[model samples]
Target: MKVAVMGAGAVGCYFAGMLARVGHQVALVGRPQHVEAFNTRGLRLETKAFDETIAVKASTDAAIAADAELVLFCVKSPDTETAGAQLAPHLAPDTLVLSLQNGTDNAERLRTVMAQPVAAAVVYVATEMAGPGHVKHHGRGELVIEPAAGSRDAADALVAAGVPTEISDNVRGELWLKLILNCAYNALSAIAQLPYGKLVEGPGIPEVIAQLVTECKAVAAAEGVTLADDVDSAVRKIVQTMPGQFSSTAQDLARGKPSEIDHLNGFIVARAQAHGLSAPANLTVHALVKLIESKAQ
Candidate 1:
């Protein structure tokens, strides 16, 4: 398959490198530095299994998507519309655009801007850009994508490339499950600039997380998405499972990049308001992160 990764950051690079290693034609559209680095030396994929450089085509222009049969739309939530528009005129009609992003609504947002088939995937991977064109994988690389036209083929192809992929009919519920987890940890971690373990050790922080999870669950229920019964336990388990890991929002704040708090906790707050419910915990943390972002600016 000829695959194009739209936002070729950490997640994009990891999957793109995997596909390229399997002999698929992969093109990465990302920052200039990443493009230059990949073109100079193949993308460095540092994983627990191995550290290898995988050859791939890299470019900054979104136009490269034109040649792709499958496009991995991996831009951040806020950039969804703009990035989709940039790729809209270039994508082939039969292109399968999978939104490999953090937020829940990115694929729907992309559909609004492009006529190509769009599908949402719940990504379960821990990766980061160690440097330009270098992706370091911590663990877990599996994807649960919504069933769509050609999605089965896409899933089969990805699984064959070493990324376990599944097509799920309940992808919306899966997305909300992940959203609830993010609402519980992301903003709080960002505001404290702490890793999960340290953040959970703070006074009354666990209670706050519980409340946030409860609020998100209420919103999800009101929106008619049935979240898992073990959702609360899942949120609490993150500290134990990935104790040293900082939330992505924390990493973004530390790097002076805009965090995705708006789409995480902020989305919950908005949905709560629409449903005539109050999400006090989520609202408070969302405001704090917004304030921190404002001060940083």
Candidate 2:
């Protein structure tokens, strides 16, 4: 299959590289630096398994998606509308677009902007741009995508390309589950410039994390999304498992790039307000990120 990845950041490059490794034609649309490196040599993928450079198509132009049968919408939440619009005028009639992103509303937001079927996919992976045209995978590469009209076929294709994917009926709930994890740690860790291990080792850290989890569960329940099993356990486990990890938001702030706080905690806070509920924890995190954003300016 011919695939086009809309945002060639860590997530986009990782999956696109996987597909290209399997002999599929994949093009990555991303920053000029990455694209130029890819065009000159090849896309470098560093993983726990091995480090290899895979040859693939790379472009800085979004219109390169015009002929693609599958388009992985991997841009950050803040760039969703603009990226969606850039691809909207050019996508093929039967193109399958999947929003492989962090926030919950990316798929719906894309649908409003594009006439094609956009599926929401929950991604569980830790990856980063180790260098120009280089994507490094830390762990966990699995996908739970919304049950869209073309989702089953898309999932099959993804699985064949070595990406574990499932077409799920409850992708929205899964998104919320991931959001809770972010709400509990992303801001706190970012502000402290600490990883999960050190973040949870501080005085009163457990109590603070507990409060955030409780507030997130309440907001999710109010919005009719089934809260994850043992929210506390999930949030706690991420620290034990990926103690050295910095959230994409944290990385963004550190690099002076724009963070996606407004879509993560801010989205939860907005939904809570809509349902006559207050999400103090989420609101607090959102405000802190905004403050950091101001300081970065």
Clashing pairs in 1: none
256 Cα displacement, candidate 1 (Å): 1.0
Query: In model 2, which range of ten residues has the least summed lDDT?
Result: 227-236
- lDDT for each residue of candidate 1 in 1-297, tens digit (9 for 90 to 100): 999999999888888888888899999999998999999998999988999998888889998777798888898899999999999899888789999888789888999999999999888677778888899987678898998887988898899999999888888888999898888888888889888889999999989998999899899989999774379677766776667767788888888889888999999999999999999999999999988888778
Question: By TM-score, who's the top model here?
Answer: 1
Please provide the root mean square deviation of candidate 2 (C-alpha atoms, Å): 1.5
| C-alpha RMSD for every candidate | 1.4, 1.5
lDDT of each: 0.88, 0.85
Candidate 1 yields a Cα-based lDDT of 0.88
Tell me the tens digit of each residue's lDDT in model 2 across 1-297: 888999999998998988888888888899999999999889998888879899988888888777888898999898899989988888876788999988778888999889888888888778889889999998778888888767888788889988999877778788889888888888887777787788889998878888878877888888788753567777867887777777888888888888888887888788889988888877887898889989878
